[model samples]
Target chain A: MIQVAVCGPRDASEAERAQAREVGRLLAGRGAVVVCGGYGGVMEAVAAGASGAGGLVVGVLSLSTREGANPHLTVAIPTGIGEARNAAVVNAGDAVIVVGGSWGTLSELALALRSGKRVVQLGGWRIADAEGAPLDGITRAGSPAEAVAATGLFV
Target chain B: MIQVAVCGPRDASEAERAQAREVGRLLAGRGAVVVCGGYGGVMEAVAAGASGAGGLVVGVLSLSTREGANPHLTVAIPTGIGEARNAAVVNAGDAVIVVGGSWGTLSELALALRSGKRVVQLGGWRIADAEGAPLDGITRAGSPAEAVAATGLFV
Candidate 1:
């Protein structure tokens, strides 16, 4: 099964949360396994959406123990490596879908791009070079549907 | 003992390689454990420097086996998780020092900053907002000595 990593912030806005949920549902509908940070905010929202659709969701957690993992996760991997787990979250995905932006989310985005993975961004932060030129290789989407389509896994 | 992460590109310039080696030597001379990506270029340079100084060096490798690891490392952890092992490299360090730039190096810098670890940059790519303002939280250094000092681990 294709694995899609959905990344976003823990302190996410309501709109971002909704978008993440929709992205999760859409990924699940396409029979993709959803991988996420497996904590709160967008992670939980995505897990909930995938679980509601009866799809498999993997939570690559920062905590070594499963203490704070979202209940919706089908498999919880306690990495116990703190924010470093963000690398694992992106690594597990065949493609990466970014919802909202945060420091942690940016790390995952950068990691995914570094590894040459297909990345689609929803509403999130913008990164540019020192001259303000936008970094290449990231596709932006207006909605969750577009985000999933941008991954090019289903099509 | 303090564990400092030394990060840089695998395709490194001679200057970057020299700088990374010096950084490793300084960290080891101060009785700190050196952690690195465990491959070629800057990774190999740092590991060589640290090993030459009779200090402990831990190579957090992406491959599951130790096939490609540098010969100078005291310990090799074959994570087999690909670029995801970058997270473990940064996680093992109390602070992170970046010697040069690459997509992979940028990811480690971003991950280290996201985790609130102190980071020092020698010569690398720059990240900024869309408007060209530089992102905060990264300390810039002109030399390997300055980079090691900036980590604040020795003091």
Candidate 2:
């Protein structure tokens, strides 16, 4: 089964949240497992969407306790490792879907790109250097469906 | 004994590398223990400096094998957890001193701030928000001594 990691900010815009939820729902509908940071905001939204669709959801928690994870998760891996859990979140997925922008989210994107994971950026800060050169490894998705489609999970 | 964490890019500038070494050396001179990511670059330089100063060093390695750690480490923890080990690096230190900037280093700083750990920024990016407001939680230091002093380790 395809495992897709969805990441975003904890304090996100309403539209961003909706988009995250939609992405989760679509991934679940495609018979793909959803993996996330296991906290609130985009992570929670995606997990909620997948769970609502009767899909498996895995939350890679920063804390050692399962209680830190969202109730929607099918499995909560309490890493007790803090933001470092971002690597675990990316490593767990065959592809990564980033919804919003944050420093931690940026780190995950960088790690995913470094590891050669298919990254579908829905709506987030474009990773660029001082020269404003965009990291071309990331594929921009116009919508939630497009994001999941970019992951090539259906293929 | 105080445990100080020194972080920077894996491919560091010559000056940045020297700064890391000095930080380690000073920490060791003050009877403090040095902790780092334990792979290479700044970690290696700091570990070498501390070991050369007859100080104890701990390397929180990302791999499961001890061979992946710098030989200067007194104790190598092969977590085999990849970048998730950054959490382990920050969590292991009483205070953190960042030498240079990188995506991984930025993640560690964010985590350190979230954890309420005293962070001394010697020569790294001043983490700011969208409005360009600097994150005020971090203290700026002019030199290695000042960074360690800012941690209240010498106070």
Clashing pairs in 2: none
- List residue ranges in candidate 2 displaced over 4 A: A62-65, A77-84, A101-107, A120-146, A149-155, B122-146
Off by over 4 Å in 1: A51-56, A74-88, A127-133, B52-56, B74-82, B129-133
Q: Report the C-alpha displacement of residue A155, candidate 1, in angstroms.
A: 2.3
Q: Estimate each model's TM-score.
A: 0.83, 0.81
Chain A (candidate 2) TM-score to true chain A: 0.96
Question: What is the per-residue lDDT of model 1 for residues B1-155, given as tens digits with 9 covering 90 to 100?
Answer: 78999999899989889998999899989999999999999999999998899889999999999998999999999998878788889889999999877778888888888879999988777776434467789999999999999998877
lDDT for each candidate structure: 0.89, 0.83
Q: Backbone clashes per model, in order?
A: 1, 0
lDDT of 2 by residue, A7-107 (tens): 88888889889999999898989899999998899989999999999999999998889875778899999988667788888898999999977766866
Residues A31-54, model 1: lDDT tens digits? 999999999999999999999998
